[model samples]
Structure formats: structure tokens, C-alpha cells
Target: MLQNNSELKSKIDQLWNKFWSGGISNPLTAIEQITYLLFMKRLDELDQKRKADAEWTGENYTSKFEGQWIPPEYRNQSEPEKFAIDKRTLRWSEFKRMQAEEMLQHVQGKVFPFLKDLNGAESNFTHHMKNAVFIIPKAALLVEAVKTIDDIFAVMEKDSQEKGQAFQDIQGDVYEFLLSEIATAGKNGQFRTPRHIIKLMADLVQPQLGHRIADPACGTGGFLLGAYQYIITELAKKAGAKDLAPDEDGFIRTSVAASLTEKAQAILQQSLYGYDIDATMVRLGLMNLMMHGIDEPNIDYQDTLSKSYSEESAYDVVLANPPFTGSIDKGDINEALQLSTTKTELLFVENIYRLLKKGGTACVIVPQGVLFSSGKAFKDLRQILVERCDLKAIITLPSGVFKPYAGVSTAILLFTKVWGAKDKITKPATENVWFYEMVADGYSLDDKRNKQQGYGDLQDIINQYHARDAATDTDRTAKYFMVPRSEIADEKNNFDLSLSRYKTDVFEEVHYDAPDVILDRLIQAEVGNLDEAELAKLQSGIVRDLLDLKGMLG
Candidate 1:
């Protein structure tokens, strides 16, 4: 989405390069340091705005930067202790003006510790920040990074004013851009899902306010954030907002904070729950949500596949693109997941199902192999979806969708938890399953993934999916159609859910001439006796023409 502003993108690129040259070359490290700086700036600005707003509304306000501060470590010392520093000095605006060396020392020693304790001891973000290091080594590099961040924010403000895009939206985009710098996949095939794909899933699932939404393997909380944004945009729409615009992916969106009421904000903050095994990812996910105005994000460092995770049937919605590879130790896998295999991909599907309350919906991404693998475990997994739940849709994604990190073909599984035989003894829960084969996702499938002009099949998938009717959407030749449960559960198919199993391929008939006649025409062309139109036809169908010619020659 930041691609719309070349200047902002260039500035962020320069900021990243500055970090690379400044001895913090690791992307995760660089992003963490950048986040700290952005947090500093945002903290100061938000506090200032709130103070002013309180004044205008004649309400009491307590600024986080108010009052004198003493280092907690030195607070119990005897009299004459000189450890007190101005609380205001921690502000980005104040320290940015200091000489580079002094600025670095103040930030490293005081500001960072203050930030670590900003939310008090009980905060998850503060707990994660306990071990965080501010490693901008050189004074000149730190100064340049801070200056560049200021310029980036300046550009964002200008763009907001000129384009009517909310400043909060631009801020979220900036953080997303920074997160995108982490290019490599983590252990267990963990990689950031494309944001547009997340948006598409959020649209199909339609996560509403007050819904307990979750992502079990949330790397940087993209799905949770997407749901949050989707909810906010819907609220903005209901609030009579007319400035809403379609994003680069064609989904209408606005700022996360725009028109957000305080009561609604608190509920939204508590609605999102995420878990990840990687400590760094957990921290990043927490900050990712916090930076988007989700105070008290529920992301934590816990492997949901492990036995320790037991929050089954708890959430109203689950949106996830879990790790596509890696298997958990059989002994360590959560007993709640009853999938017959140790395959993480298969088990995660079961885990997501368990995570949902009865009748709750989930939109998950899984490897295409899960759809039609010959293994009995795979068949059982599909059967669980088809028999135990209402398997609504299977949207196959292009292989290149995860380019530069992975090339594995994937698909989105949209389903709802249901009581199959227990409630309906005569038949299964799912009556029909919809299928859509996505050809493109609005970007080039190469490493760069530059945005294309149109959102190929993305918009259509959303519209056609919501509007699909079992009786009307039966044309298998179209891009999207529905298949009856009996057909999907046929013995020969073995519960295969792959789109190719049911989709009808239309073939065109081609008329061919007799071999002798085709050879005579080619021979005439060889002798330079044929007209331009005859030569063009022969060239256009060279394979067929040459096959006929070779047979006649033989």
C-alpha cells in the first residue's frame, strides 16, 4: 500500500540502509530498533494530542511525560542522590535535538529502560522488552536514523493532508513496510502472509466487533490486524464516513483509529488473540498490534500445537495462515487435536476447528497437498471437514503467491464448526462446497511482487463467494462454482477437495485436413507456390501441420 507514495517508500528504504550500514544488519534487529524510535515519536505525539484534547473538553489529563523521574534502581538510595532526570527528556522531540553522542547515551541508558517499564511490570510488551537491546552502534548512524524517521513522518503528514488519507492509516502502513523487510522465512516454514490475501480472508469471514478473533500462528499479527482494520473500516462506514477508499488490493479501508470510540477501542483491543512459538515473532506481533493502536494486544509466545495450549471452542472467529512445514513431536502435540497424523499442516486445521465455538467460522490457508493427498491421514482430515463441519469454500492460490520465501501451492479453507451426526443423524453438516481457483492476487508473482493494475480475481472471489447460491453456482466451467457433498464424498474421489477434481475443463474442437492434402500444401509452400495467407496459416499451426507433413513424407 505504501507503493502509492514513492517518496515515503524511498525514505523508508534509506532508513533501512542506514541501519544496515550502522552494524545492525539483521532485519529483525533493525526493525526492532526502528520500532523503538517510532514508538518514542508516537508516544510523545499521542500524549500531546490527548493533553490538548482534554483541555478542550475540560477534562482531567495525566500525561505520561509529566512529573520528575528518578531511576527506580537508585530511588532507595540515601539523600543527595543525583539520579533524577527530566521525564520530558525521553521524548523523541527533545532528544532528537541533542548532540549525537549524548543523544545515544541518554537513549541507551535512560530512555530505553523507561520504555521497557512504560506499561508497568504487568504488560506483555514490557515483559518482552526486558531483553531488548538498542544497538544503533555509531552516533552518526543514530542521528541519521532519527532524522530520517522525522522526515518520513513529515512526508506521511503531507500525504495525509493532500490525499485525505488518515494519518493513522499512513502510520500503520509505515510499520507494515518495516515489517516487510524481514524477508527470510522463520523455522517451521513461518513467513508473513501477503497483506492483501489477509484482507481477502477478513472480507470473506467478516469478523465483527465483539467477536473473539484469533490467529493461532500469528507471525507479526497480520491476520489479527487485518481483522481489526476490517472492523474499523466497517465502523467508519456506519459512522457516515465518505472518505473511505479502496486499498491497493481493492478492499475499502480507513485508519484503524478513525471514528473509533473509547468503548469500542477497549473491546477491539481485547478481541484479538494470537500465539507464536518464536520469541522474536511474539514480541514483533505484540508491537505490531500495539503500533496500530491496539493497546493490550493478546499475542503471546506459546506453541498452539503443544500440549500446553488448551483454549478449545473458545473463539468466535479464527483467521490464520499457519506454518506450512514442520511437524511437532507426537508426544508434544496437543491432545485436543485429533488429526490422525503428526503433520503440522493437518493438525493445525484440526486445532483451528477446535479453537472455534460451535457455528463459529474460520478462514485458514493450507498447502494444496492437503486437498488431495493420497495418504489416509489426508483423507481423514478432509473427511473431518466435510463430515464434522460445514466446509464452505476452497480457494486455490497460485504457487508464486509466497515467492522469494516459498513456492508451495496453497489454498484457503473456509469452514464452520458444526455438530455433524450428533445433531443431524441422517446427513452430514456440509451440503455443498464452493470452489474458486484464484489466478492472480493483484501483484506480480515474482520476487519483487510489484502491484498490478487490477486485483485479478480478488474482488471477484469476494463478491461471487458471498453471492454464491447452491442452485445457481453449479456451472463447473466458470471460475467459481459449488459441488454437492455427495459428489465430493464419492468413493472414487476419496474425499478429495482439490478444485481440479470437480472443475470442468472446456475444450475447443479443431478441424484438421487430410494428411496428403496438408503435405501437399506444405510442399507447395516449400516450393514458394503458396500465398501469404496459406503460409501464415501453416506457421500458426506449425505443430499440427508439421505432424501431418511428417506422416505423409514417411
Candidate 2:
């Protein structure tokens, strides 16, 4: 959507350049600072909206900004001597109108502390807000950033209204676009998944409202948000709302609040969760979910593959594109994961399996080498998927899916945990595994990833997945088909899951001219000075001979 608004992008780019020029060069930190400002603005707007609604409806409503405040200098003084400042002055709407220097000082002195204390000590925002620092360094930079953000939000409001999208939906898009900027800024191993691919995975998983969903390596919480949006859209449709409408890039924008009952919304909010190793990413993920209307997203800073994480068999649906190019220390790896290596990819895959409850399902992305690598850890992980769970689908993605950061080929592994009575791991329920080779994902595979029309396979993959039949999908030459588990278990295959391993290429036979005919044509053309017509005929004969040879080779 940002691609459709060049002016909006130019404003954002100017904002980023201002940050770099203002001394905050770290992309992650820049994003965090921007997030704080956006949060401040949204908080004031939310309070204002609630207050107006309460006045109109004659309902008792408490505003977050309606409270007394203590000045910093008087806080340590005796109660009688201490002076108080109105909390209303700390509101973003009020402080943003102050002079540049005064505004910077007030935000650092009062507003940030207020943000830290928001909700309560137990809220996710409060927990992550503990270490938040405003380091813009210059009031001019802050003022410029604030103005740019105001413009950004204004454009977002107009765009959302014109497109019949919720403000929160546009907010999510804005956050995603910012995240993509971070990815392009060269944050190592932190590329956010393309929105279209996230939607495709969400559709394949078809997460329900009550289902518990999680992402272990949730960079910016894209997959978790995708699942949340899908669930919301389905709920809306069930409530007689129109089917989700796609935007220019094929993303469906829907209002979750319009469809679900209060109780259902509360449950939906708690049903989504995420975990990440990076503290900065955890903060971003939480903010990303919060901006999209999730009041209390369960995102935390925890290495799911490390011993510090202990929530086994907890989630119902696990969706992730875990980091593939790193490995953890052997001693720090969780004891619950039985993999023999410290490879983060393998451990994260196994960790996802462990995190699933009985009958739980997961759709995860892994490097392509995981499909056919002869490494013991690789083969062992595949064995577990094939023998212990219902291996549903192996969708191979193009190598450039994570372009500019990583061109490593990857695939989505969809499987369900099978536990017998007493939660014992049982034999797999898999009979056949569906394989889909995605050559394009609606965007060019290049680093730019510009949108392209009629080149993506995501929707077709989703549609064919629901209608797939092992009996009818027997054409190995096609992009979508099923391969029986027996064939996958063949000794020569070594449990290879790559589509190329099972797919049969159709080669056509051809015939060619004899070598003598080609040699004679060449000699005739090069021999004595012949008439122009004779030479022309000989040239034509030589071309025919070459064509015949090429056809035979084909």
C-alpha cells in the first residue's frame, strides 16, 4: 500500500534521513523512537475518542489521561511542600504544541514516565517500557519527526476512509512498511516476511478464533498478525459482513471490532502470542500488535530454543519463519528438544513441535536444505515429522523470498502433532504429503521485490490445498500434487522431501539429420565461387541441418 502513495513514502524517507542526520543511526533504535512517538499520539487520540463516546452515550468511562501528576523536583519533598502539575499537560496533544526545546524536555521529564506507568505494572506495555529512553538528541530532529509522523497519520486516515479500511488496518500497514525499511537497512537476519506470503500461510493454516497461535521467532510479529487478521475476517464473514476485500497488493483489510462480540474479541486477543530473542524486536512486536488493536499481545523476550523457555505443549497453532543462518550454544539449548545439533533452524523446528499440544498444528518456514540434507540432525528432524506427526504439506518457496537479506531457499512445513492416550507421542497419521512449488509470490523475486500482476501462486496454492485429493493429484509434473509417505520413505530417497526428488519431468524424444548431411551442406557453401542463388540455397540447407540437430538434442 505504501507503494501506491509516493508522497507518503517520501515523507517517511525524509523522517528516516532526519534521524540519521540527528545522530540516531541505528535502524532498530530509530524505529523504536518512532514507535514511541506514534504510541504517544495514538494514546491521546484513543483517550479523546473514548471521552467523546462516553459523553454521547451517557456511560461512565475513565480516561487514561484523567489523573493528577507530580512535578519531578517536588516528588522527593514532603507531601505538603510538593507541587503538582495537571496530567492533562502531559498528553501528547498538549505537549506537541509546546516550543521545540520545552517539548523535548517535557517528554523526557514527564511523558515517558507516564507511558511507562500506563495500564499497570502487570501490562505488557509497562514491562517493556521499563528501559525505554528518548534519545533523539536534538529538539529540531524531534520536531521534524513529529511533523512527519503527523503527516503520515493524516495520509493514513484519508487512505483508510477512501478504501473502506479501518484506521487500525492502515496503522498495521504503516508499521509493516516501516519494518520493511528496517529490513532494507540491513539488519542482519531480521527480514520481515512478505505480507502476501504471510497471508498464504495463514490461509493454509486457517486459524480459528479460539485457537492459540504463536510465533517463536516472530520478527515484527508479521505471521501472528496475519493469523489474527484471517481469524477476524472469518468472524466478520460469519456475522454477515462482506467477504474480505483485497487491496492493490492482494492483502485483505478488515475491521476486527465490527464483527466479533466483546467476549469473542477478548478471547481472540489472548489467543495470539509470540516470542523473540531480541529485546528490541520484542518491543517492536508488542507495539506492532498493539497498534493493530490487540490490547495485550503476549510477546516476550525469550529464546524459545534455549533452556530459559519451558512452555511445552502450550500452543494450538504455531506459525513462524525462524532464523535459519545461526546456531545456539550447545549448553544453552533446551533439554526438551532432542535434536543432536546446535543448529538454530533444526532446534527451532523441533522446539515448535514441542510447543504444540496434542492434535496441535504448525506451519513453519525452513531453509531448503532441511528437506534433503544428509546431516544426521536434518534427517532426524525429518524422520520425526514423518513418523511422529501428520506431515500435511511441504510448500517450497523461491530462494529469493527473503531477498536482500537472505537468498536461501526455504519451504513451509505443515504438520500436526499426533499424541495417543496420556499424551504419549504416537505414530504419524500421515498417508501422503502435498507438495507445492511456488515459483513466484506476487512480487518479483529480486531484491526490490516490486509487485507484479498475475505472477503469484499464493492464492492458487490456497485454493488447491483445500480441494486437494491424493487420487486426482497424481500428476507429478504439476506444481501441486501429493506424494505418498511410502514413496518418501524409499531407501534411495532417505526421506527426501524436496519436490524435485519426487516430481517426474516429462522429456520428449526427438530425431535429427545424420552428420554426413550437415558436413555436405557446410562444404557446399564454402567450396568454389558458386552463384549467389546456389550460395543462398546452401546457407538455407546449413540452417536446416543445425535446426534438425538442435531438435534431436532437445
Candidate 3:
């Protein structure tokens, strides 16, 4: 979402070069230095406005936190505009009046709290302020470091094209880097969702205004962000307004601005909830929400599985690409969400069920193997979902969805918690699983693609999904087919959610050589007719395959 943020980039790079050259000994020191620069910029922008307005003490608290504090000798300045990185010795001499911890305590309790009290603002800066270290007294390079960063953000503009942050776009690399830096124990396989796929999935789920959305695993909050964009996009389109880019704020029409402002206000007050096991993810989630201009996100740092969530059918929409963790420690899940079983996806499925309100909808990304992974666990899950919720659709995504890095053959599994299902629609439960197979799903399993070529061409599959009624098992041209509920029941309640089971093979037209042409070939050079026994065997095989198709259609 960055645009014209070149200042941020150049300044950040400059700061990095300076810090690396100085040979800062600790990783914490690097993060602290960068954070300190961000803190100061934020502080100056906020306080200057208050001071100009004479809002503090009725007498203007004119710029106490700005670059004015650094001594000129320690400052990095030009002839006109001046700023400085306070020298190490000078910083110690001036700041030695307090201990390192006390400096941090003062910043948190006094300086940071002043910014926290601004009107029309609600921030937990005080909370995260605990992690905002002021180790200048010990890591004295830290004070000298703030100037290099001031130079960085001062010059480089942030790139808007990069998906998550202005820094990286290698798909999930944002979450990957964050996990390495902040939360290495980011629960097995809990990486971020791919961006394009997130957008596609959100479009299909179609969460609307006033609907509550939740992602229990909530890795770096990709789904929540996607859903937010989706809803906002639809709302904007409905209001006949442009989907203004973040960088295009100056182009906002009065009508669009008013609508977006109202919608933004509504969301902060009413919708959006998320939880994660990792505190670091929770912080990232909050930052993400804040960057997207959502205030007061109800994102808590808690283990949804470990906590008892009793409010069954509470949310309107649920979207998750949960960690494909295979099994869990017996003690991990709370008694409510804890099944007698251990498979992570299965537990999450049940957890989603409990979280949804009646008639609520949910879309989940799951390992394709789950569809047919034979087990008492899978069978029970299939039975519960088909019976309790209207199992609507299953999209078999290509195996390379997470490729080159993590190649997992995944599928989009969807369900709706409704008043009830038509218990006996004269079909088996196993047959009821509408399996849609995209040709893209069978593409090269190598976990990488040419970025120019794009990945997973599933628009046709999505077309068929939206064409719920027009779709059928008879039209072999389409990528999807459905079995009757009775048929699904026949799989002995094994709702594998695999597409291959439901989609009939599309037989391309084969042109056979004419009899005269064959005779001409024989006359010109060639071969004899097949013997009776061989031809009979071929005929038998054809007959058997026809019967298989016939049965698959039913």
C-alpha cells in the first residue's frame, strides 16, 4: 500500500548501512534503532499539531520532541535544513541523569502517554511501549543511530506495489521474515497465505457490510485484510465510487470520501475479530489493521484452540488458511475445541463450526490429502460437516500452490452453517460433496512458476462455482460435478473434499482414420487386421470404462 514512500526506503537503507558499518553487536539493537526513528517521526507529527493548536496546557507544548533536542555538533545537518544523530559521549553525558531502564520508563510513562491522549485517537502505544527499548545508555550506538534513520525515511519513498509492506513481495516472505525475527515458534506451518489466492478466495466468500469476520489461526492477518478489501471494494462499487488507491487520496471525490469514512468508522466499532497463539502475530495484525486505517481491531493475542470458545454460531463469516499442522500435543487444545482426535485441520474444522452463527458461511484452505486420507478421524469430520452444515463446495487447487518453498496440494473447502440440511435427499452423503477439479490443480508440481505467466488459472472453476444451479455432472465440459447427498452418504460419510473424485475426465475429441484411408494404407504398404482375441480384450476394457463413467455420473 506504499506510494511515494521513497523517503522511507532510502532512509531505512541509509540507516541499515550505517548500523552495519558501525558493527552493532546485537540484533535487538538494530530493531530498536529503527523503531526509535519511527517513534520520533510519529511523535513529532502528532505533537506539533497539538502544540500549534494550543491544545496542551492551554499554552502550546511547542515541539519538545523534535530534532531540536540534538546538539548541533552531534547533528547531521545541511546549510539550510538541520538534523542530527547525537554523538555517543554527548548522549551519555546528557541522558546519564537516568538509568537506561528509567529512560525507557519515562518515555513510556510520560512522553509516549502524552501522544496517546490526543483527541480522535486510540492507541496501545503504552502496551507495545514495553517492547520499545531505549537502550542508549548501554547500546550507546543507538543514540548515534537515530540520525542515519532520519536520513533514510527522509529520502526513500515507500513502494505501493509491494503487497504487505514496501520492502518485500516474494509471497509470504513478509510473514516468513517476521516469523524468523519475532516469533520463530510460529506454530508449525502457520505461514502467510499467498496474496493473489487470498484475493480470489475472498471474492468467492463475498463477505458483506455488517458481517463479523474471524480467522482463528490468523497468520499475519492476510485473510482478514483480503476480506476487508473485498467488502470495501464491493461497498464502493455499489455506491458508484472509485476504489481509490491509497496513494491517490488527493483524488478522492466528496461522495467517495464520505462513504469510505463512514464505512471505516463502522468497521472499527462493529466488525472484525481475530486471535493468534503468537503474541508477535497479534502485534503484526494490529499494525496491519492500523496501516489499512482500521482502528480498534479486536485482535487478541490468545490461543483460540487452547481457550474455551463457548459462543457457538457467533460469527457471520469465517476464513482461514490455517497452519497445516498434522497433529497437536494432547494438552494444547482447550476442552471445548479439543476433539478426542489430534489432526490440526480436523480440529480447526470443528472450531470453525463452533464459531459460526446459524446460516453463517465459511471458506477454508486444506491439504488435498484430507479428502481421502483414510481414518476414523476424517470420516467423523465428514459426517459432522455434511450433517450439521450444508457442505457447499470443494475446489481442488494445484499442488504447487505453496511451491518451491512449501509444496502442499491444497483445496478450497467451503461450508455453510444453516438451519438444517435436507437429511435424506435420496443420495449418499459421500456423493453430496461437490468436487470441482481445475486443470490448474494438476499442473507441474514443481513449487515455482514464472511470475510473468501467473499461477493457478482457476477463473473457469470459479465460474462453475458461481454457476451452482447451471452446473451439473452431465456437462463434462465444466470442471465440476456433484454427487447426490445419498451418494456422499454412501462413501460411508467420507467427505474427502477431493475434486478428482467428482470431476469426470474431459475427453478431447479423437478423430479416427476412415476405413477407406486404412485400406489405402494397407494397399500402399502395410499391415494386417488385428486378431479376434486381441480385439475382444480391447472391447472388454472399453465396456468396463464406460460402466465406470456411468457409475461416477450417478
Best by TM-score: 1
lDDT of 3 by residue, 327-405 (tens): 7777767676634687788888888877888788889988776677778777777766777777888877766666644
Clash tally, candidates in order:
0, 0, 34
> Tell me, what's the RMSD of every candidate?
4.5, 5.1, 12.8
lDDT of each: 0.86, 0.82, 0.56
Q: Candidate 1, after superposition: displacement of residue 201 in Å?
A: 0.6
Candidate 1 lDDT tens digits, 290-330: 76778688988889999898788899999999887778899
Candidates 1 and 2 compared by TM-score, better number: 1
Candidate 3 achieves a global lDDT of 0.56
TM-score of candidate 3 on Cα atoms, chains taken together: 0.64
lDDT of 3 at 272: 81
Predicted structure 1: clash tally:
0
Task: Check candidate 1 and list the clashing pairs.
Answer: none
Report lDDT (Cα) of residue 289, candidate 2: 81
TM-score ranking of the models: 1, 2, 3
lDDT: worst 10-residue window of model 2:
419-428
Which of 1 and 3 is the better model by lDDT?
A: 1
Model 1 misses residue 398 by how many Å?
1.2
